[model samples]
Target: MSITVEKFVEEGRDPFSLEVVAGHEYLGRIIKEAALNRPGLALAGFFQHFAHLRVQVLGLAENAYLKSLTPDERGQRLHRLYQKKIPCVVLTRNRQPSSEILECAEAFKVPILKTPMITNRFINLATLLMENLTAPLVRYQGTMLEIMGIGVLMEGQAGIGKSETALALIERGHSLVSDDLTVLRKDSTGAIVGYADDMTRYHMEIRGLGIIHVPSLFGVASMRREMHLDLVVRLERFDPKKEYDRTGLNSETISILGADVPLLTIPVAAGRDIAHVVEVAALNQKLKQLGHDAAKELDEKLVRALERKRRM
Candidate 1:
């Protein structure tokens, strides 16, 4: 997916206050590439390998270089650089563009933006936002919640009580990221980050309860905007005939947006406290991350005891 320059300026948050200085009509230009480029070499009349498709950034050094040039020289260089039809240009540290550059921007119909953030800070923030905005995404029918700091995605068939389980977790001091439908995206580091849809964010549907706002009823502490999905818990109805894994040694995983997240299946019954079971599953996942696997340890101990008995 591509992000428009106009959307970037409008939706950009703290550390990236972008204001368009020129080319208002070109705000509709799409930023197809997530990576940014410093146009220092391009301004020096080098066009062999110019990354014209990426967002051009003018930092302290580039701005100072422009000021040192003669008016005619600066105008010529700016004109040549903008001729490449770059997506957009951003001036960092609230630096004012030279008249030649601004004129070139208007003449070439390229959008020029300015931000108060320093060079490196702005680049980092912009790149991050661009990457996230264009990242691969998948929507799952589940409820995402944070239990003991671990992101647990409760997934099952419709009307399987995903939202009710999340509500219970909230009552237990946990936080809800999304309910009903969770949008998962793979970040740059290959971790799956889950977020709520704009329309459904902080809203949960319960049987006979209708649509309810989670944060409004549970307070701000019970809701989160987004979270890195760490584990998936599948709630299945208890069945006497179905054989389930009795030991916790099952290394099950569910793939979402190309990231494999650990999965746990809990049998749900009339008296089963599924909320508490999911909470324990999340805590167990944390322990596994800390290099402790209780199931494996138990199996190893049993093997050792069997070997000793044979020796005796």
Candidate 2:
């Protein structure tokens, strides 16, 4: 998952207003480190233990130091830092690069970026963006919806009614996250976040109908851009020959991006209300989160009763 300086600049353009100030042709520079480096010590001629692989951020204080130094000394320091082979440099507060620094950037072929954001804020957001870019992601054919604050991924084969189930949930006041396809990513907090692709966000397709914009038909509140995944509902065709779990004693789970998510397989059948069942499942998941597991509690109670009878 190596991220290049060019990709970082393009992705951060909208949030950080990042733009290349120098080394345009050398944009292919790979960012070995996902973190930022404040080169205050490097600028002051300290080379020991320098993070040369990280992106160097030149903030106001570093600019001030450069202003205080003579031309020859400034060029010496910039050349020394560039000689260390840093991946790139970022000038914060929209600071103009010094001729000495620009010369070093060109000579070393190190990409230099500039942003109008404050030093600390830009560093924070840029670090976050880097994390997002490198986060573990998985895409699946499914419809995701937020029902009563619970994120649910409805997965099944084609014509299994995932989109239709999502539509029904929408009619019942639930918000649609994504339809037909959902992308899940693990965030820094170790939770899976499900979201729709940019082009298909807030849109759905029905069997006989064409594509429909979710918010336009159901109002703005009926659509959600993303949500923390809490449950996964797998819809399958109901067959009388197959046996299904009648007792909720054994809970099933599926791994998504290394995290075990609660899984429920609901058999699709005539007159079966899947949307209502999924909504209840979501509420049950919420209860489990609050430390109340009905199935486990009942199983425990039955075990205690049988033990007492055997003792008697």
Best by lDDT: 2
Q: What does the lDDT come to for candidate 1? A: 0.88
Clashing pairs in 2: none
lDDT of 2: 0.92
Candidate 2 lDDT trough over 10 residues, lowest sum: 242-251
Cα-based lDDT for every prediction: 0.88, 0.92
Worst 10 residues of 1 by lDDT: 8-17
* Candidate 1 lDDT tens digits, 1-312: 778888878867454878988888999888777678999988888888888888899999998888889989998999898888888899988888778878888887888899999989888888888888788998998899988889999999987788888889999999999998999999999999999999889888999999999889989999999999999999998888987888988789887877788988888889888998999889999999999999999999999999999999
**Residues 210-284, candidate 2, lDDT per residue (tens digit)?**
899889899999999899999999999998898888887778999999999999989999899988999999999
Best candidate per TM-score, number?
Answer: 2
